[model samples]
Target chain A: MSAGLSIAREEWRLWARSRVVLLAGVIVAVLLVVTSALTALRVADEAEARAARQASAEATFLAQPDRHPHRMVHYGHYAFRTPPPLAAFDPGVDAVTGQSIFLEGHRQNTAMFADARAGADLGGFAGLTPANIYQLLLPLLLIIIGHGVLLRERESGTLAVLLAQGQSALTLAGGKALALAGVVGAFLLPVTALAAYGAARGEPALTAALMVAGYGLYLAVWAALILAVSLWVRQRSVALGVLIFVWLLTALVVPRLGINAGSAAIDAPGKIESDLVMLAEQRKLGDGHNAADPAFAALQKQVLEQYGAEKVEELPMNWRGVVAGYSEKKLTDLMNQYAEKRMAQEAEQSRIVTLFGFASPTLAVGAASRTLAGTDLATHHRFLREAEALRFDFVQGLNDLHATKLTFADDAKRSADPEAEKRTRVNAAAWRLLDDFRFVPDPAAARAARAALPLAMLLGWLVLLGGAIVAGARRLRP
Target chain B: MIPALEARSLSLVRDGTTVLEDVSFTVAPGEIYALLGGNGAGKSTTLLTFLGFLAPSCGSVLVNGRAVAEDVDGARSAIAYLPEAASLYGHLDAYENLGYFLDLAARKVSRAAMDEALDQVALPREARGRRMQSYSKGMRQKTAIALALLRDTPILLLDEPTSGLDPVAIDEFHDMLKGLADAGRSVLMVTHDVYGACQVADRVGLLRGGRLVGSFEAAAGERIDTETVHAAFAAREAA
Candidate 1:
């Protein structure tokens, strides 16, 4: 213990003298502070804007004067997903996935207003969030700082001196790791403060804690690996070169290339393709307005049988509204089937990309961090599904009003006869009965559950690197 | 008393080739022994074996009468080793280097004692606080020697200890070795300088092609002859 601690102390003393490393550390600390504060402000402003827009959309729909209920269904509403509180820290897929959906009848709209669509580098490093600093930059900084820890000693012949001082190779390795851990902790300070701020601002405490834990483990993995490689290699330049390559592979190359490959392999249908296919299928269901259309012959007869009437005038309520309601159910079913298949493919792609985490702790911590932040793929999908549900519910409510509120004789010739058209309009107060679109984000337990495997993968990396350090210590050159 | 350091028929093979072949030597308490050899003649390899950095391919190397292979850390604990040129951390001052190394040895010394050791090595007190990166080769060597002195171990192993020192510094270093020997500490230093080896050693061994080909010893209160040992070394290399 004395040997290890002394080694660690000496290392710290040496680092204090290294101007370049110290300067780099100071710069990174300041960068994290400035970027995280800016991100918090952006998130707050975005949430407010989305809420305002959602309210405006609802007001616009309800403000309409008396009109055919069918017209209200076409007028539609909007659902805006308020940013998750922890988005100030991670932001995850939010920048690429969009936050608002246009919820109209018959058509299930994709989310609009994604930053990626606005040419924001797909939320790449150009986006500059705190999560990027933790996932990408910290490990690279550690690599640059500690790559030569052991090699410098051996090259300068100090390793022999230390070894001859009765320091076991294992102890020397342990001491270096302890010292590196100190540096990693120092780097984590700003992020730790960010976590505290988030918790104070009402983000889930467990998620913040886990984010902190995941990042710590992620850096520890890099530290152990740096020591192990330094112990194994013979030269400082070689260790630096090898570690940089490793950093590049883990932090950048694998994640981008692997996700792209996974997405390619799954071949999920695009929004345009799915929409075109649905339009074709909807055509088979025919136009819902014309009760004389052959597509509704069976439905028209069914209504007539129920009423024991031979024709439209004999029915008490308008038959067109019943047909409109029935046709909508079929179209929504088609929309659901396509939506579920697309979501399944998207989920599969995300799963495959997550499997790449096994190769890179950076990816593992990234996935876990985003999940805890409630900005992951599942959350985005949840928003879409919920918006669709509200779209279906409100559209059908309008259809029910259309059927029971107006007479068949007035609705059929309303276009040609002004009096009939005036009689056909329903009360303007009917829009009040519609359900509002409120986004329910996944619970903390669900986020924690989804993050479980990625966090475990990070743990697995730490353990694996730890095992390498132990095994490599024995092989350390004196 | 058990020999302070011993190598009983030590031989080492690395990468399918032998570097040391059946070499045997010992230093009694208070004795100064030097192994003289040219490059790749295995002088450093023998010192490494005593420190247990390299396991013996055959035979045994021991320190304080314990088999080094069986108790390597114990062997290392009993000895202080100074490598060729003694490259201390260029970013650390002499005092910091000594303190760090002494800390690694799990021993603590007072600042006054550290000053005393540095004074004995003739290192400038002003330079003791400056980073070694600005130090001359001789100053760095002096700092390493001060570190070895501070270790206070019963046995010392030095590989090319006087490589960068001037004639005056070399003389001072040889005199220090004699004083250490007189105080009953054993030393085993490996070097190629015939005069330097003859100047300090109570006994000397000549190594050629990884074999100990010749040996010399001084009478009581005397030193080995440089000319005779140098002649023998040249003859063996020529053969």
Candidate 2:
């Protein structure tokens, strides 16, 4: 056998005989399996619940009784976001981002019932999810196993004997790295199986592949880093201390700091502030509620001139409906402008956090995993945009119904005369004619493209860590 | 004929401090050379320089006529080393440890060969299969010696090989060294045990302050006395 393999075999033998290492391995394996299974079940359950809620909301909308088209607009629709199948492997931002949005006329509501808000106590802990285990705990396990790989030899004086026996330091280091990499592979098996199951169950194959590739690179980075530290540090205890500190700094501390830094770097307006601004803009532009408001007097005159009519009575259509449509369009434009600004700000915060990935491979892999799973801030924004578009179409369609189907004479007399009020009610069949709001997720290629940067950052870390290992090996001596 | 090991005016500096200075020595084939020194006397530093673990600031260490710095692996392949307290993987059995290190040295041995080396080193056949962690210091030494025998190198480098062994175990270890010397292998030992050196070494060198100051040889059919070796160390202290 080659010297590296021989060394690795001895390490395997040693690990087998060590009850502590064996017990640690078993505990980590059990944690991985249980967390992965629970995450898959939770994701699947949420998806089913969201689909059911969406169906129920659609049914309720179409079942409305006869009412004025404007009343129907007030009874707005609900849009529920469905998680992609691969979310089982990595729920990503789904734990924090809200899952359902309320859509109505002249208003866009924020998504509500986010887990972070609902499960406040547990949200800070991330609920023992699979991604959390891989991100936080698995690397710790690697550090425990590998911190002594070289230090033991040095402490025991086997290093001198081995060196004098013609064993190159590179071969010894390579052997230890190979051994730890084997452990990494074993740790990754259950998660890889979960990802494959997701792919087989109709999740995008390319996304599953990318997720697995990303995690492989991530774990490899840890293994290389652990080995490098082991070889470079002089004492076993010191090596362990250094590795633990590294794990804490990179995995636990830096991500939180990066998020805070990112938030500090880019400011996003809160919901109330944005709502107040939109309200102010709405007032400044024109109130769609009153047809005779001075804000639309100019619009009314322009309409009269375009139709060559001197007054509303001479117009071909109910001028009230035309005025309502114009006001709805103006309000929709103002709402979209503010919403886009807020999304841009949130995106900037996320970008700042992504830049820190260059320093911490853990964060890089976490970002890539979320992006590929379609559970990131970008995906959340996409859902909101799609929901807004659907809302505009649904509300505007009702406005068109008001313009063409309901007569202005009846609408104007409805409050005073019961018969006129009854005549102004459109048929409930119109609700059924409106299309359901369906959110189509971005294609696998698009998500892969979006995630490509973080993934490359992770790969870059792996390459740099490989260089460290090589340099450490070159410097190994007794 | 090429000497098994030679150091000509070797000097080594570590961390900007000179640890070994102008040391010269040679161990011909089938001869045993023991170096005696107090703590910080640069005995271990000399061995490390010979193993190419530390490069000399001046001169060179040659194994079988090849400079250690110029061809470290080639020089190392000709040596089997035993540290002051030879340590093996605590979890592995003596035989397994022997096989592993032998394989590390690019020598694959059969089970019977491993058993023979263990037996030759006087380690009990039953104890060879048990974990080395439970073995006593003497047994660990025997295991290290068995590894050296299995390596079958031309030269053996031992750093205080008998320091921790009991008197009886030390005597047996001296006999083992004598047997290796008789078998045409050169041995260089670094130790504080003057009597142990007199018993096993053909020539003894006294080191003081990183320099070899005095030497005594055991002529044919003659053994160097303990007092003669003591006087050499005393003379250096007086000077």
Candidate 3:
């Protein structure tokens, strides 16, 4: 262990003395700091803007003039999908997906006002978030710095001296790996601080801890891989070339392959096609607009039976409002079925893409980081689901007022009689009955649960590469 | 007593090519034996087999009477190797490189002791603190010799130990090596310097085409004749 520490310390001294390597490390660290700051600012500005807009929306809803409850239903509220707090570290899919959904009656709305759609060239392959840098560039940096350590030993005749000193191959490899891990840890300084920062700010500690561990394992895999390859190849140039090729294969090429393969393997319906199918499916189901049609005659009979009314006018409440309530429920359920199916398809696509995480550490960490940050597709789907629930609740709340407040005769004669139309309007204060919509993210435990598979894959890579290093170290010769 | 270093019928074949044949030699304790050969004569190959860096196709090498193949660590623990053109870390000064390599051997030395070893090799005190990258070939060779000396092992393996030294330093190195041998250390050095081998070595073995062609041993208080070995070397190359 002392010998290993000696080598590790020597490696550090050598690196510090090397101006080029030190400069590269400084540059990467500066980039991480700058990107981290910029991402934090962007997330803050976005969250503030969304919150302000949401507040304004609620104020406008409550200030509405007296009107028929149906008109108030059309003045729908907006649920802004608030950025998950740790998005400063990893924006994930948040940049591409829309943030706000316009919740109204009858139709389920797609989210809107996405950063990508607003011409923000960010957060995907070109993403400069701290997570992106850690995932993509950190491994490359490790490869560039470590590709020559073992090769230099043989090239400089130091291996023979080291070996002749009773140093086993295992010790040499262990020492080299220790040195590389130290370098990687230096890179993680900002990451560790970011986690602590997130934890202090009330992001789930487990999620933050898992994110750091996932990256730790990921970098370990690279460190071991670099050492193993350097030990296996004797020539300096060959070791460097092979390591660079591997970096490109895993970092650049394999991730793209995963996405393309997932798309080809399980092609989900395009947005337009999905929308059209849902529209067609809705048409074949109950026509909520014609509440008095034969399609809802059974619903009318059920309502009458519940009220024990001899005639529609004789009932205590307006029958049209009752029909509105029943029809909306049936229509909402149909929409939910389609929405869930689409979500399932997308989740399947993600699953197919994630299987490639085994092929690339970049993919594994990216998946795990995004899921932990609550910036993944699953979170977005959750937002839509929550918005739909709010949509139904508010719409139903207005429908209930429609049923209880207005008389059946007043609603029927309102279009033809001006006096009845005035009386048919419910007070705008009724909008206060609706609750303000706040997006509650999935519990931290659930998000961590979802991240398990990719994190395990990262761990698996570490084990496989670590084992190879051990096996290869035994074969190392001067 | 068992010989401090021995190669019994040692042979090596690398990449389907014979690098060393069934050659045999041993250096007893307190003796200096030099294996002299021209380039590609399997001189370095012999040293590597003893270090367990390369496995011989047939036969075995032993250090301190233990087969190197069976207890490589044990064999290596007793030996200090100085490879040809022995490159120290250019990024580190002499003390740091020496300290690192010595530490790997699990030996501890004080700065004064390091300075002493450096002084014995005649490396100027002023140049010892500078990175070896700034040093000339001869200076680097001197630092490597210091490292090997500081290892304090029983056996020493020097591959072309005086390749870059001037006449004065080469003589100084030979005397230092002789002093180590006198102190009960065994030396097995491979070199193509016929005159230097005859000047310092107690026994000189001529290696030709992976075979030990001839050996010359000095009598007590006498040195091996250089011209005789040189002519044999020249004749073998001519053939």
Candidate 4:
């Protein structure tokens, strides 16, 4: 056997003999299995529940009683986003971003019932998913197992003897790194199995493989880091302390700090502020309610010119419905503009967070994992956008029915005249004509493209860390 | 004949302080040289330089006629080292540790060969499979010696190899050193045991203030006593 392999084999034998190491390994494996099973179960339950709720909402919308088209518009509809399949592996940003959104004409609602808000007693800490365990805890286990790999040799005067036996320092460092990396691989096996199972259950095979790659690179970074520290530091105690501190700074502290930094760097307008702004813009632009508010005078003239009619009474269709459609167009356009601005701001904040990946590779891997899992903010925004589009289509369809089926005279007189109100009611069959809200996920190619930057950043971290390990190996001395 | 190990007026300065100065020595094939010194007399420093752990500020260290600085690995391949209190992996058995070290030295030996090497060093067959952590000082040293025998290097460097061994174990260790020298291997041992040096070394050199001040040869039909070795260190202290 090669010297490096021999060293690694001996290290494995020693680890097998050590009861504490074996116990710790078993505990980590058990925790990973239990947590992964629980997370998968929870995610599956949520997905099924969301699908059922969505079906019920659609049924309720289509089962509305015969009523005036405007009244039905006021009733609105709800859109519940089902969790993506990979969320079982890494439910990134899912807990914080609510699942269901209320869509209506002239208004866009924020997604409500976020998991984080519902489980506020845990304060965003309730979801101890397997991904979190692997990213945060497994590295600590590696540190504990490997911190003494080199320092013990130094302290016991074995390093000098080993070197004198013609073992190059680089080979020794490589051997220890290989041993620790093997531990890392063992720790990752359960996670890989979970991902493979996820893929087998009809999840995107490429996405599952990407998740494994992202996390595998993450653990490899830790292995290299632990080995580097173990070889560079002179004392076991100091190495332990340094590695623990690194874990704290990278895994725990940097993510939180990055969020704060991102928020501070790019200010996303609050929901209330956005809503108030959109409301003011609507009022200034003219509420779609009034037919002769002078705002639609130009629109009225345009409709008349197109039909070649000199007066409203001469028009074939109800002028009220035409005015409503025109006004609705203006309102929807303004709302879309505001939504785009808000999305831009959110994107900027996310960009700032991504930039911090240079400071901590953990953050980079987290970003890449979320992007591949399709639970990121961008996916949430996509859901909202699709819901908004469906709302426009259904509301506009109702307005079209009112213009053709109900007479202009009856619609105007319905508030005062009971018989006219009865005449203005459209049949319940019209509701069935409206299309259902369906969210088409972003294409896999698009997700892969979006995740490339963070993935590259992670790879960059690995390269730099690899360089440091090599440099450290060169400096090794008894 | 080429010397198995040679130091040519070697001088080493650590942290701007001279630890070894103008010291020179050689051990021929089938010879044992013992260096006696007080604390901080550069005995260990010379061994470190010869092991290529440190580069001399002036002069050179050659193992098997190759400069250690220019060809560290090549020079190292020709030597074996047993450090003071020689420690192996506490978690690994003696045979396993020896096998690991042998692999490190780029030599692959069979289990029977390993057992034979252990036998040569008087390590009990049963103790070969026991973890080094449970071994006494003598047993650990014997394991280290077994590794050296497995390496089969022409030159051996030992730094206080018998410092903590019991009298009987030390006697056995001395016999092992004699056996190694008779087998055409060269050994250089650094110690403070004057009587032990007189019993086993082919020649004994006394070092004081980083300099080799006195030398006695057992091979030259010279009867060197413990008092003569003590006087060499005492005179340096008096000066």
* Top candidate (DockQ): 2
DockQ score for model 3? 0.81
Interface Cα RMSD of candidate 4: 1.2
Worst 10 residues of 3 chain A by lDDT: A117-126
Tens digits of per-residue lDDT for model 2, A228-250? 88888899899889989988898
User: iRMS for model 2?
Assistant: 1.0
Could you give candidate 3's per-residue lDDT for residues A11-83 as a string of tens digits? 8888888888988899898889888887887788777877787778878888998999988888888888777
What is candidate 4's lDDT per residue for A249-340, written digit by digit as tens? Answer: 98889888989998888888877798886786688767567777887788789888999999776789988887777777788888889888
Q: Which candidate wins on TM-score?
A: 2
lDDT score at residue A24, model 4, on the 0-100 scale: 91
What's model 3's TM-score? 0.95
- The residue-by-residue lDDT of candidate 3 on B1-239, one tens digit each, is 89999989988998988888999999999999999999999999999999988988999999999999999888888888888877689988899988888777777899999999999878999998898899987788888878877887888899998987889878888988898899898999999999999999999999988999889999889999999989988998898
Q: Kindly give the stretch of ten consecutive residues in candidate 1 chain B with the minimal lDDT sum.
A: B98-107
Off by over 4 Å in 2: A116-126, B235-239
> Whole-model lDDT for model 1 versus the true structure?
0.86
- Evaluated on chain A only, model 1 obtains a TM-score of 0.94
User: Whole-model lDDT for model 3 versus the true structure?
Assistant: 0.86
Please give the fraction of native interface contacts (Cα pairs under 8 Å between A and B) kept by each candidate: 0.91, 0.91, 0.91, 0.91
lDDT of 2: 0.85
